[model samples]
Target: MFNRLRCGSGLIQETVPRFGFGPGQENLFVHKFTFSTSKRLDRDKSLIYNSQNKPLPRLDPSVVGTGNRKRAQPVIQPSEKFNYSVRKALELIYYEEESRIPTLFPAGLKLSRYLKSRTLPLEIDLVSRAVLYNTRQSKLEKIHLQRWAPVDFDKNCAFSYLVARTPAEYAVLVTIFREISRLEPNFKPRTLFDHGSGLCTGYWAANTVFGKLTEMFCVDPSTDMNDLATNIIQQGVQNVPLPKGINFRLKAPKTISLKYDLCLSAYTLMEVKGSLERLDIVHSLWERLEEGGCMVLVEQGTNAGFQIISEARDFLLRLCEADERDGIVDNEKKGEVLAPCPHNHPCPRYHHDTVPCNFSVKYSLFDIPYFSTEDVHNDLFSYIVIKKGRREGFRFPRLVEEPLKTKNNFYCRLCTGSGMLQEVMCNKKHKDLFHLSKFLHWGDEMPVHLEYTDGKEKPRPVIDRSERSMSSGEHFRDSKKEKDFKEEKDSKEEKDSKEEKDSKEEKDSIVKNGI
Candidate 1:
């Protein structure tokens, strides 16, 4: 109660309005609030959508066991705040059947309203399970379904909104952060914009990424969904307030009125239905990005998801050419593929059903207490990031396959700009390169030079002594240094608390000895 300042109605206007513009600042920290009174029909059902850009922290070399095999684990962990929401979801749908009252949010005034508006149907439990399965399977098979409004809004909001949808978005945002951080380690976003801001999953993800956001805006179309999102988002704010400045709107903006550091269209493009309309909306959102800003789009890791990402990728490539001819921009700044593709070339795996242009990253799976089996999750997803400016980096390509040992050398499948899909080998004679190749992973970029065109043979890409590969080594060293610093700090703190530790030990001895 003390942490949050309630402002659902006219509370903001009545407050002291401590919002201020810092010295020598014009547009910095400008806080404004406006509500759209206009309503809409045909918005019964709510499908909320959800970002982040943090590079995955380097793995400790010591983590590998004596056998030299390293176990890859999810680099991200859900915050305690997020876990609290998950637990709340568990109570709502499951415990509600037993007539259990929610104990977490004591401010049940709004929640009770939703509960009293209608009875929780007997079929809610079954329906929630069926709906979850349908959504999960739809993603796997690339099947599209038109969402009809839920009969029981509470159950839907609990299972679909808080449990399933929010968590899925969080996973995508985690990977986005990791990949983005790897691309630009110093990326500190001032503003984050979420399209289809269902429940502000992107907001939560942004916290796990940048840890600081100056301002954030979320827009959704469904009133029911918006209400639920607002309620939950506000509740989340009670514990952990992220992005110091935050706002949520009920309606979508007609156009991009303000530029953003990061713009996300996660699992949202599919809602547009029409390819052209989706592309047009994506283009508009892209335009809203400030120069050097990043735009990330996440879709279900199905064939349809792959296709939509492919179309968006091609659209980005042609944007510069079209702009040059139509005079859309003065210099025609080209968009660059930030991740999932080493270069902006046609996806060779486009038609390959078995191997589509996608990468699967795993996240920690969450299970509800009693219904763990039914709520089992697969954290796999397909996503792509496109940058507004040139993606200046390497010339070779990225490995889509894990490096494996052959009869004499190490080899992997690489997705290259000119070479397309090709097998690259690291000869054993090149001991340095070979040893480095051993560490080459499925999502890592390959450093060797290879042919862009299959028609001719090109010289092997040369890796100089001061090549970019050393960045991984540098990251390892930096991580080690940080670990050492933390250990030293912890040791000093422990030594300083020696008296307290001895006192605790003495008390423990007395208790154990039954004194």
Candidate 2:
């Protein structure tokens, strides 16, 4: 005995007892049901069986997706920050004078050329060997000893730097600080230590990223530079008071009484006369960093700049290891690399590749006199962030290059946690991973797990340059293939023209014959 229940455009056949039953008696016996639909249901509709004919829960529209797959989200890249302080400083100093505007262009060019040609001072021991080898003379020349001259940051030089370099420096610092903020949302620094703080760019950038700070200690050796920075802080026009808890000094304090939550050294190490002095400065900065604080170091994107950053990274790591071994520092408080690297092992790029690992940020150019030819420019920089704590357990692979999106798959060159550079591919077959790959950018961490074997790492495969171009969504053809294509196209055009001419001639003949 069966009963037919009417549903929307469907029939449900249910098994029940032959006798009429009351509401409570319906559940006394076991019942079986089969449902059939005359037409297909819409995607938004769902059919559910209910013996009591009660109302059902509504579905959430937001959770619905195409084929139930997760939707792809947009990737967040480094953003440009409008430097109001720099703009105000420039306007107050130059006063929009037409005469002063034209002079800025030449000064900027001269400053750019000088900074690019600058190099570290040569060692005294190397000076003697080089003189003997080059001049073939027994005695070293005094000229060789006097070759290295330190840069003098006079008023003119300071003005030139503020015009040519401040915007780029601010942009780089902002990018680094934003990265730290994004990765560690709870990081709020109470005090900042800006080493070699030229024009106090670090303070401005930090303020932009982390709001107000309790104290900022800035140290620089140039009195003119310090004065310029102070003037900029005061905005020159209205004699605005300096920000609270901000201090400037011509040299660092001798005692280590104060520890800061954030320490920054940007484009400063390269100015040191020797490597030993740079190391000493790095160690001192590390000492001043409070426990669990972060230390940031940034340099130019050149190979020399990369070398400087790497040296600092290695020296700090070695120092931490030595301290732990000597029972001076606990394992829990050891310093670790925080960004642009996924592992504490030696950098693969430093040991294996000739090219340096660097990233670029596009920043808006200041509206200075004669300097606004391009509205935006790219600032290439190398930076390393070190935090004083044990390394986190979960680490992600960093994309070393811009991801390539082909028609079939996405390719990414990654620096894995295993200390190897690998090229990985993601396709539609990998549902979630493919969706995630679409949002990846260079210098971003990939949220995927990788397994490693216990043996030696494998070598990277040698890929042809042409193939790489094609993989990057570029259509490239060999010379022979291009020549053949051209020939075929020409022949087809010739044949079509000849046939048109023949048809016209035949029609003319027919008209002449009067057929």
RMSD (Å) per prediction: 26.6, 26.7
Query: Model 2, range 72-150, lDDT digits (tens) per residue?
Result: 3222222233344445666777465324646765686587655544444665676656655655343343343333357
Q: How accurate locally is residue 145 in candidate 2, as Cα lDDT from 0 to 100?
A: 37
User: How well does each candidate superpose onto the true structure, as a TM-score?
Assistant: 0.58, 0.68
For model 2, the stretches where C-alpha displacement exceeds 4 angstroms are 1-83, 91-99, 117-120, 134-149, 237-241, 367-374, 391-393, 452-515
lDDT tens per residue, model 1, 392-437: 5554467765555555676555676662555555666756566666
Candidate lDDT values, in order: 0.58, 0.70
- Count: clashes, candidate 1: 9
After aligning candidate 2 to the native by TM-score, how far in Å is the CA of 351 from where it should be? Answer: 0.8
State the RMSD for candidate 1: 26.6
Best by lDDT: 2
